[model samples]
Target: MTPPRLRPLAAALALLAAAAGVLAAPAPAAAQSAADVAVAREIFIEGSEFAKQGNWDQARERYERSLAIKRAPITLYSLGVAQQQTGLLVEALESFRAFLVEPSAPATKEYEPLARQAVQDLERRVAALEIRLSPGNVAGLAVKLDGVTVPVAALDRPRMINPGTHVVTASARGYREVRRSVSAAPGSRAILVLNLERDGVARPAAGPRAVAPRGLPAGEVAAAEPAAGNLVPIALLVGGLTTFAAGVAVGLVGVVNASDAPTRDGDAADAARAQALAGDLVAGAGLAAAGAGALVLLLGRPPESAPRAPAPRAAVSPLGLTVRF
Candidate 1:
């Protein structure tokens, strides 16, 4: 419906409008983080240097910092490597898996095979523990492993852990607290069951001689009271005797030196005199300590039952009533 010159002009305007729209669109995500990219690059380089020195601990720390600032696939791969070298098998496996989840790009596509291998290796080497609670529905229950609280939601699954001894503790209102020690071996799975008993329930006798049932699981071992002995008194007695013997030995040496002093002159006589004085001081201290230890040991003993003293007698005297001692 319009003239030919007008149609050409309108077409030119539409083309210009389309070009402007393209320019106004947001830039690629990579172009938007120029400052962060610079900082991340610097930190990643530092991490790489640490890795070169075989200082994986420091390398892991640096890689973590860099990854927090900017998420690059290469950084994730590096972090996984550092974590693996630091004995963090579970964490390394997770990091490697995360790296593989990122889009395959030129910077990290080469690491895909390595990451997959790491995942398989970690799966075989990681230790896991499954804790089952008897009467799991108890109210106000709390569970801890190696002093760290475990979330209730995580109780259903096997937890990955480093290979070592770990203590698991459980407590609830109106229940006796329970603690158990578990040893986790590499590439092994352990299951522990904790039984919660109500407070005021009669527990097995926990005397020093009490022993757990032989067939019971380690987690179900009965609690026993530690052995009771007067160790302090015994230790003092033994130490005192040993010290006394040493003092006697020293005193004998001093006596021999003094005996020879009468036949010596100058420095020999002075040395003998000094030795004698030192021996006397040492012997005196030893004797005092021995006496104190003996006294303590004697005092620590239970008193023997003795006949009661006769009641005081009162008798009338010539001048007044008197009492007899």
Candidate 2:
């Protein structure tokens, strides 16, 4: 009953309906359970609707969920499209690449070129960053990108990231963790250098041993080089002073005694002279100890400390992706 000119239009409509029918039956390779297929189809339908409304974020979310449920090449391509619309150039590029690499099937043959084109276009619009520690072989060194650990082997390679701010952290067992934020523009490269310092050496010695207490005049503070107290010098001084006192007391006893005869003399006079000689020897030892103590206190070196500098820290928060390509 159709007019001759409308026959071609009717044929086209019939073909389109047939294609829809074919798509309605999940492709054999999809291999998803009935429940999975149902969920995936529903979510895919919602994503398509959102795409039609230009609600790209919602569309991307739905597409992502569908892809998670079932790894369909069609969903991946659609997900890539949604990502592109949402200003996620890097994500779109990844999705497109994922789609193309998925096992090729007859159903997905027609869209491969679209994926390739998208990848090519996005390649020129993203940024790359290289992170390195000054001493790459620092023991126990660990690096993280956005809090996810990055392997040591990958540290030398540049990461292709979205054009925005990203946080990178480098840490080690005995060294302070280094955190830095970098802003990347489209088609630009950013290099981040982390110079880590040993834990106690990363800050000025602001503890009790700080050369100057805060609020004191600059000159007075500089002149105040007192330690919390060095145990070595105090120990030596105490020992020397004690020895010197003991020697002096022994010598005083010797001076008070008159025993100067012989070591074997059993008489009181001989005993007194022996005691006096012993006292003199003790006093001489005391004098030597006291002199040594004074020399140590005056000439011994002050405590040696590793110089410290203020540490630099920055935090990288999630920033909205800038639309590129």
Candidate 3:
């Protein structure tokens, strides 16, 4: 037996319990397995408990897991709340939009206005960033916003983002990378410009050929200018030529000694034989070194007309969702 005034309170309690039951169940269109429904219910309950304790991160994680297992309007709304609490305004806005688009039910009908209000608030809070590339249409150009790759198609338009400092990086093959830091306030729009320069062309006449060595004549230095960065090959060539000349001089002396040895004593003949062997070894080594230096010089010489590498297009990572009312 209940008092007359308490009868209304009892009816309200019964209606609230019915609403909770409806919220826990899957939508009419959802064909989730019984086991998945049970698991999602359990996780959703855990998330609710965490939210009550003001542990938004834990709540968000549990709600995300529950949603992954089974998506429910109630879970989406709860996830949006958690995301809003965690300062993810952009994500919260998306979650709220997703929730509002779900099939309306008596249990979720009350959340529609709330989700719409949150969306409006978040729309005002989120910031937008527009990125521009100098000398546009660069080949193999890759752009990243706060370490996440931005899609090329989205570059022409402003990107919705959270209010904070963001780092933008732009890079391309054979071009110097450009990085810029931008600060975005709530409801503000920012523009970032990236100017990329060709790499390794600051000095076209760089390397050893740029300067003439001490004691070298200007005419000889000018002649050597055709070979860029060819200092090592030139050094090897010079060393080989000097060695070959010494070997030739030694071999001639040995030949003279050998020719004179047949007329001299036995000891003189033995000395001449040793000298000839040494000269042959030195001459063979000099020939091999000279050949290697020549080969290296010929191979290392830069081509006069080389084609530029084809620029490769970078793959862009997708961000955000297309939401329609």
Candidate 4:
């Protein structure tokens, strides 16, 4: 008796309703673990009590616990409210963001303005700092800012720093520690670059001079003297002299033997041996001279004269030219 089109439409509506019912069914006994549900209930009760007592910090902690257990929108909304009341604008903004992710979230119109205001206030309180590494070298080093150690994984990552002057230090084994003072303003950023180098052994003391905080100026580059315990030059000198003397002595013996020989064949062999010995002596003498020169250069003294001149006086002419005779 019913029309064909109406019957088909009714059947389709029934099927869709069945599917919705299945999807919206409560959690099954096997699906809802008793321990998890208990934890969630406990967190909700504790958070409610804390909020009723006007203890915002305790309320925030309980709400965070509830979030960790189960991310319910109502719990998140309450947490955001508590965080905002406690002046934790950043935390409130994050909480509201989490609540908005739920499809069945309630009170969209009421919470939207609050979340936006929290975000705006948080932005004003935070500062961005640019950290640059000199020479783009960041190997085997650790960087720290304001007593908080930054992870090596976060190197070159721009950070949101709190407003104030902060102590920045870069340190590595086998290298000098580089440190500097940096200041950051609200909603502003400061750039800090660090360069470090390997530290060498200190040279022996030079003559007395004015000591600056970071050692002497460039013009006061004092010549570094070799330590008395450096045995390399002495060893080279001894070895070269011994070889030279032995070669000369052997050459003299070969020459004497060649002159005394009666047979021309034996004389030729002795002369050849003498020539080889003289060549070795010459090579050893060259090495000895090089070793001595290196020692002298290493132990040399720098000139003590000051080379600075007084500044020239300006002329009072229209062209501002000074006349030099």
Candidate 5:
């Protein structure tokens, strides 16, 4: 009883001291070897020289190499800044994002502001184009932004675009090629749609007499015209007529058998079957009539002729017969 409380207090104090000691200990040295340091130094020197000379491309290369040796947030931020100066907005954004991943880096505040600005500028550049598509067709169509082919699935969302004029083209088999020119502002978005038309041999123009000289043709006129003749419609009509004739024959046989009744019980069954057959026959007859009508309509009417030039008046003869012009 005299020592239990003292033991627990002593254990707690020991644990606290160990924690303090761990916290006070110096961090382990970075694992960078001498060779790594030499490489990093060389890269830094080269990048600095490039920056001084305003050679942003070469500067970016050198800075990227230095980062490859060791992830230095400050170097990465500097590289992004150089890229931005060179109009590499997309690349700059990527670099800034990478730099921000370093939680312990002191340059996060500066990098974040610059990164946001770069993203805003990129957005503006993408917002200036207007895209329109025709025939409401969007299959197998690819869109490119600033020469980069954007995935069709990604078209619904905003994409990073570069400032300046963009050339857009749409292509698909069996459709005409469409091209458009668009301009994008810094940090803006552009919407574009492409219309596609069927590609086929141009139809020959009909003679003047074949042209319709009035308003839209009526449905009856269209149906009556022989120009609508095609194999599919003819086949459909034939099939419909055949089925209708078969149905009518079956119905007539059923009706005839039902009329010659024998016993009461059998007569009821026969009548029921006959009635069902009659219903089917009626349906088939309707179909046959429709088919016949369609076929007749298709083959019976002549195409509307174009207006013809009036004939010259003929000289009148004494015998009251008109002479030809």
Candidate 6:
């Protein structure tokens, strides 16, 4: 029983038979096995018969099986037609698009307009989904659209679907079944979210990760120790203070010697002049040590918080003693 809509294209059956014959010819390269081609031929014939009988489901199945054995381009169009009759608008659109994209004989080119028209019509009947999931590992969770199990790989992607009231379901081992009903509109993007919760309780959506003002990760934030300064500053201060004290004592002795020196004693006066000169040089060294110690103390500080920076690298000063981060 030929469908009323397909009767006008009865001439296409003869063309398809001719195309199948040409396809069956042995190729010099990229040829399929004789057994596979024979099987495809048998299945294709069966699909055509089923199609004529108006058993679109059986016809679609036969065409699909035939294409699986060997990609017969003719079956793509027939499959599209069968899918259209069976209310598989989305699948039909895909089939017609594939038919147009595939390289077929010039004889098949005449059907290009028909394929394009089928695609246009199906596009208006098909519904699309924009899937969403809350942040976290959703691995092993199963999803279904109207009792048909959705592939895990298809999650979180925009996909074409039949326009109808669908019961979306999500399930996992320890999670309670999450079910939501949605009325899908034709040629529109509808959001579908399957948020599975633990056992009987609902889980709240996860928020953004918290970060410390210090550049440490959440785990390391509390564990990170305060900056401990190097021993250079302490050493500088100790040496400077000791040197200054010794210089002060030496200078006092030199001052007393210089003040006590007699004008008549040339040797004593010469000795006093040497002591005063040594005292002045020692006091100058003490002043230099004190200045260096003060500089180090004043310049060195614990690093400030860098919220977004990489753990700052340690840098040694040009003097090679001070450490700056």
Scored by lDDT, the top model is 3
Number of the top-ranking candidate, with TM-score as the measure: 3
Model 4 weakest lDDT span, ten residues long: 302-311
What's the lDDT for residue 71 in model 3? Answer: 75
Ranking of models by lDDT: 3, 1, 6, 2, 4, 5
Residue 299 shift from truth in candidate 3, angstroms:
43
Q: Which has the better TM-score: candidate 1, or candidate 4?
A: 1
> In candidate 2, what are the lDDT values of residues 179-290, reduced to their tens digit?
8888999989888888776664223333343344577765664344433233455655677667667766766665455444344455765666666667667656656655
Tens digits of lDDT, candidate 1, 1-325: 3331212233223323332333233446866366766676677777776776677789889889878877766777778878888888878888989989988765445457767877888888889999998778888999999999999889999999877888999888877788999998889999999988776633344333323456655444332111112344556567777777777777778778777775666677778777777767776777776676677557654112222222234443343322211
Q: What residue pairs clash in candidate 1, if any at all? A: none
Q: What TM-score, over all chains together, does every model reach?
A: 0.50, 0.54, 0.56, 0.43, 0.42, 0.52
Whole-model Cα lDDT per candidate?
0.69, 0.68, 0.74, 0.59, 0.58, 0.69
- Candidate 3 per-residue lDDT, tens place, 1-325, comes to 3331112233233323433575466555557777877887778777776776678899899889988988777788788878888888889989999999899887767667777888988999999999998756888989999899998888999999899999999888877788888999999999888877766533233323334557777567655554544655666677777787787778778778878886655887778867877877787787777776787678865233432222224444444332111
Model 4 agreement with the true structure over 23-127: per-residue lDDT tens digits:
233445766465765666567667666666667689779878866765556566667767766766556657767766656433233444455555667667667
For residue 66, give model 2's deviation from the true position in Å: 0.6
Against the true structure, candidate 4 reaches a TM-score of 0.43
The C-alpha RMSD in Å for every predicted model, in order, reads 28.7, 17.9, 18.1, 25.0, 28.1, 20.0
lDDT of 5 by residue, 1-325 (tens): 2331112233223323332332233333775665775666567666766766667688778877877775565666667766776777667767767766766433235335555565555444433444555654545776666567866666556556557777887666666667777777776767766667656654444432333335646444443334344434555566677777677777766666666657546966668576757758665775876576576557643223322233224443333222111
Report the candidate with higher TM-score, 2 versus 5. 2
Model 5 RMSD, rounded to 1 decimal: 28.1
| Clashing residue pair totals per candidate (backbone < 3 A) | 0, 8, 0, 0, 26, 0
Give residue 126's lDDT in candidate 3 (0 to 100).
96
| Decoy 2 TM-score against native | 0.54
Q: Which ten residues in a row have the lowest lDDT in candidate 1?
A: 302-311
User: What does candidate 6 score in Cα RMSD to the true structure?
Assistant: 20.0
List runs of model 5 lying over 4 Å from the truth: 1-41, 64-75, 106-132, 135-138, 203-325
